[model samples]
Target: MYPDYAKKPRNVRLGLCTNDFAPHGQYGRTYSCWPIIITPYNLPPSMCMSSKYMFLTMVIPGLSNPKHLIDVYLEPLIEELLQLWHHGRKACYFDWHRQFLPEHHPYRRNKKAFTKNRIENKVARPRLTGNQPLDRVANISLAVEMPLSLPDGYSSDHKWTKKTIFWDLSYWSTLLIQHNLDVMHIEKNVFDSIFNTIMDIKGKIKDNMNAHRNLKIIWNRPELELDERRPNIMPKVVYTLVKEQKRRVCEWIRGLKFPDGYASNLPRCVDMTELRMHGMKSHDWHVFMQKLIQIAFREMLPEHVWSALTKVSLLLQRICSTTVDVHKFHELENSVSIIMCNLEKIFPPAFIDSIEHLIVHLSYEARVGGPV
Candidate 1:
């Protein structure tokens, strides 16, 4: 059996993260710097995330993002990583996150929630024990480098962008988690979709005329089928609030208060004139969704709609907790699966896109890779 190298003493498990950001206080400039950061996950959670522990390995001076070409500049760092590949194991990155969830979870039994009529009954195959993945990749030709001589079904059935330079490291395949999900960005997206749809904001709402028509064709709902009476008008659905309800929700938010340093001035972001929220950063949305979302809109929306939103808020709350209970991750996973299934049944198709679906994986990620 393979030992968990990441937990071994004196092991330096490096996390490589890079993104382009506009320099603070230079608001006038349109340019941004692409900076790569290295953090030692070997440190305790309290110290690992601190600025004191983060090391800036390299910075690409940029007026524009180098995109994939950033890899070209990272050659030196890649070489160093190859040399320091201390664990010396070989493996493959698993794509499925749901494999970490309990096998008997009801999320896998629902037909309508995910795909059409088909339930998720198959358990995800476990990762191959040893040299299998390396052998498999050796047969996969990189299409970017050699386009003409690609093997059969390269583009259609299985897509291989390129075996990344990181895979060259001796210990790379030993990691349980290859990439961490950006929880904040995903949280903001879910918040935006739900809030905008319920507010019935013109351009932002997903429960528009088109989605209504699509739903009518797909499912049997007597109340929603009333659009046949007034073909020109998009009949109002229960998910969206009436104008008065929208106004009341906005007014409540406009005067809302929170303890100092608990969250930002959320009241400033609510625009009574437009009846929509604005200027909210990702953190602000995170705080609002996990804490104030269900409470603020409690009586304004229908019982079912409000209940679904509250469940989502609770899921976010538990996942983002300061302390993660490793034993309860299975319970968390089961809850998330059911919550997502309920939301899928309630929200419109556009509202249930990738960001919303990403909720199903958050628990699994936390189980394998703790809080991030």
Candidate 2:
């Protein structure tokens, strides 16, 4: 939002307006010759909002010790977020860069003890932070929502990134492993759940877009053509776009599939659809599985491991951006299994041995529960 090419003063203004700063309580009566005397009316509402928001949002929460908020609130927020979203969590001053508030931006080289710039930014979700560093500013773009819980036996398969890798290793490894396995067992069923959920969401979004498109199209439709029922729905423009998107998704799923020697070779998108025909279970989630997996690998795996990861990442990136194609199934499966094996190598021998044990434990547990 801040204009970049301007002179220092203008840049500062742009940054200040964007940064969170509270309204001045009441300016000093003194008039200084060196500094330009500016009145309160001259200040933007955003600046005032920024300051008050920071004080209320950051300071009041931790009056005991500055670190208390960081430890109790910020730390937990980060940890919980890492668990929930699989991304690194960091907090910074809302607007330290322009006026130089202390620790305004976590990525900054120098930070102060008292200034306010506290914000939690996800390392993986860089867009969420945007160009300006501010806290609690109203944002309408890119709002994310995630399901918090899934069916009794299902779990989210989101990946945790490097930023949270250490945290995950310390606290989430066991729970995450169990969840991952549970998810894999019911993977086919979950696809149906995902597809239906996405379809519903897309349906709504498509409805709105279609409505708007129809209004515009009707307004411009030639007078003679207007009487022909206005075509009930907007012209196929929006529908075509929606179709293209769904087609891409289906193609992506199909592309990722590989041929198996046996009938149950591997679960294709079709299998996922079949499972969906029946009731499917799921959880609410903010993170997409593709991004989550990338974050997890980046956080958990070493550089050497990335060589293999890069290959799969490229495939996944394509799948995420475009759609699924079953024809690519063999490549996808083999690539993923290899990557999984490589990741298995990253853990300590004990961890690996424990996984072996866990496999047995899970098998027994699965049997007790019913089928795998």
Name the top TM-score candidate.
1
lDDT of 1 by residue, 214-261 (tens): 455444444554467686587767788888888888888878777888
**Candidate 2 lDDT by residue in tens digits, 227-300:** 34665443332111243444444444344433453122122323333322222123211112333333433433
As a whole number from 0 to 100, the lDDT of residue 70 in candidate 2 is: 40
Best by lDDT: 1
Against the true structure, candidate 2 reaches a TM-score of: 0.18
How many clashing pairs per prediction, in order? 0, 41
lDDT scores in order: 0.72, 0.30
Model 2 / residue 255 / CA error / Å: 32
Where is model 1 more than 4 Å wrong at Cα?
A: 1-155
How far is 232's C-alpha from truth in model 2 (Å)? 17
lDDT of 2 at 223: 19
